[model samples]
Target chain A: MVRSKFFVSLISSLGIIALSVAWMPVPDAAAADPNTFNRLMKPPSKRNPPPTQDGIHDPGSIGTQGLQTPREAFKPLPPAQSGNYVDWVKAFDAKKIQPRFDSKDPKAKPVIMDLTIVRQVKGSMPDVIFPHKQHTEWLDCSNCHPVPFVPQKGANQMSMASIMLGESCGVCHGKVAFPVADCRRCHTETKGKATKTSAKAAAKPAKSKKK
Target chain B: MQATIHITKLRLLPVAMLLLVGSAAVRAEFGDIVLNNVSEQQGMRPVIFQHWFHRIRFQCRVCHNELKFEMRVGATQVTMDQISQGRFCGACHNGEIAWTVENCDLCHTGKPGLTTKIQGGHETKGPGIW
Candidate 1:
């Protein structure tokens, strides 16, 4: 009787152990790691994933399946590291993509303003050349004027901290535009040696400063 | 032997909890907007607006100024009727500029019962992740 009782208990215990092991959660490869959940830490290989694969779209949605992948659309466009991974300015220059200036009015033309605002930084960093040509080619004055920017000289108090926090230039730069990681792109004007763009900006009387 | 088994089960409890926490944080991307004002009440999934994709093609003023989409989350009370009538999303999604409102699943792809909020936190005030 004692031997039978021992076998019964051992079998029951083994069954319980098996059940518990089965119940234990399996580590999911797709699950976000709590330690590295920030979107900025997303792997470079995963950047600019297809609409279906990107978490933004519902993978199971029929619309997602019908949509073209970024890789497919960007195959011929110049590539970059961040945002949509396509150098939009370069792509526009190369005539690879012609984004409609106005969504409603197909014939609407963008108000292309040729101006540059040189913001002299306090440190060794080169002065930031805010080229209106590049921005105006894609955006409208109302997009930044009288709101984020006051459209007045020496009005906006910009800092790297503020920009990084998604204020001012941060509104577009780190999000849709090229990230702030490309430091030299903005800080191109060296001390006492104004680049051709900045020299032209300086030559033009501050008449268009409000713009 | 039974005591040892019980201890092993206890050790697994924390690991399971950690997995649950990790899964919860995987929902939203960088510029994703989850709009749920009237979705759950109407028995529809909340909309997940992909800002990055739209901004890729059009400038911010196209939506923020012309379309009158409020910069703040939940500020614009977008409705199906408004959309069908060619306001907000309908401005472009009228089967011409982009996809039409008939394609419900494309925009309204948020999981059931999500509240109206901008995922990845407030874009302007959130910690600089980039």
Candidate 2:
């Protein structure tokens, strides 16, 4: 009877130890499931604390510049689409763009530019497409900043021939930037007909433009 | 043995609660945003502040770490002489890395109580955060 009593006590103690271990707090060094941890990461409060400079996607307070910054400098010119390449480049200078916080943003909220292709200038507007992200990577805010960019829509009468002849994009396209030789680089085609036009001029422009 | 387990749990519960409260206080201490340093010169306070909003644009080396901006605000003691040297703001503001500080409107700004309109809606210049 004494031996039986001791065994019962030992078994009970072991059972109790098991229960204690089960009830103990689990260390949360890492999460078991990824999805659960994602939702769990949300701040405890429902209220979104005010936008910190580093908080939102927009580079806020950490800054802003007003029309004149409460100061004066020849009263900023009437904001307009650039009349010339220099005007366009100057406009790009005014908007100081810091490198982005989120690299994915350009791809996510992309701005699509309508392309106009022509057999030649003054011929037909050939519908060329300009990807905002593609151009933004190679350039800076000044690349298309002030009086260059009209505050409103339907501004800046940019010509394709001028751009091709080393004005705006041609500044780097034929030399440093992606060359104009690649037709499909900017245009889409049903069966590569435009490719022939692009190729014919490609080999010649590359050779003579350097001089 | 059972009593020991109960006591341990009870003790842990209060400690956990205290830790939670302590962390909340630290977050609240910072309030809204983290400002690096404030600059003052003879009662004139330019936002010598460096906020993270503009920091990540380039690297800290571009200014504080590389350009060697004094960690303390106004410590660099920027003057006309230094402006011409291409140090501090002159590093980028010298018509190269950035615009030059030659113009009165560029850095002096001439605004008495104007803040920047950047992330914080301050309408301040590029130097708001520093």
Candidate 3:
């Protein structure tokens, strides 16, 4: 009985480990479940989805004053706060323009624009204004060139699937390049529709409309 | 038998590469990019142009209006010869506006790439593998 119990415990422990990895978080490029990105990117548009806005958000986690979102309450290079990436993910900013580099290094060129990434197999890529000049400040040309980039296009199997899985641009964008969690920063629609409609209202609390 | 298989595989490799080098990567829905909608052509679609950084310098009108170029790839008809003359891309490729055309290798050297790096000064490793 003792031996069998030990074996059962071992198997159960392994099962828990696997399950936890599921929630541990997808790599920067690999992408977490879209429902999560949608929830984060799309304000609490409906009741089914949880609220991600500033005031009254995650009220269960805090009091009613409003959730302390960096993008909402804090702006301008983010105040000196003491929180992890979660704090950064929950915030949004309209003024802080996204950073990018003019890629003079041929090898650092990305495989595809985010607009056409295959959602079925590959996750959506953040439309990073990739900072080429900035990256060269630290990395070597061989790091991305020759090994990852081919001498021409379509030679590399770089897609959202590969990138998120850490193949192409995602190799760095997810791990180093400011991360892919900030949705609106990179995916800004030139023709403003949502923001023009709900700039401040997005941060306000939605009261229970009387039936 | 092993020797023959190895040689045969090696011989067919170039042909396979030729087909692959011609096509761009399968499309993605998002990222910093240039989109050119291929028009009037069947094999290659119009190039999707991305204004990732070009937007930093001149206004959209700089290229769209001042240059009188269309959004579509072939729509502008930037002949390899014309670029060398400062016509389409040549207008600025003279080391002042952009890279010099004498370095045809900059844009036209590689096999048809799905994408190309517009910036210069740093070393550029071609993105094609085929």
Winning candidate number (lDDT): 1
Candidate 3 regions with alpha-carbon error over 4 angstroms: A1-211, B1-50, B109-130
Tens digit of per-residue lDDT, candidate 3, span B17-82:
444432322221111222222221323322322232243233333454446654222345555466
B46: Cα error in model 3, Å: 12
Residues B48-123, model 2: lDDT tens digits: 2223223324432245444565332234556556758876666666775555654433233112333322222221
Candidate 2 Cα errors over 4 Å, as ranges: A1-211, B1-50, B109-130
lDDT score for residue A144 of model 3: 54
What tens digits encode model 1's per-residue C-alpha lDDT throughout B1-130?
7755655565565556545543443434345667888987888777877665675677666887788876656778989999999999999999888889999877777655556665532334432232
**Cα lDDT of model 2 overall?**
0.36
The 10 consecutive residues of candidate 1 chain A with the worst lDDT sum are A202-211
Model 2, span A118-192: residue lDDT tens: 222233433344434334433343434442444333454556465564444554343223345544544433233
Strongest candidate by TM-score: 1
Better of 1 and 3 by TM-score: 1
lDDT of 1 by residue, A115-154 (tens): 7777878778977777888888877787778878999888
Docking class of 2: incorrect
The candidate with the higher lDDT, 1 or 2, is 1
Residue-by-residue lDDT tens digits, candidate 3, A162-182: 555445665444432334444
DockQ of each: 0.35, 0.06, 0.01
List runs of model 1 lying over 4 Å from the truth.
Answer: A1-44, A194-211, B1-32, B55-57, B72-74, B111-130
Q: Which scores better on TM-score, 2 or 3?
A: 3
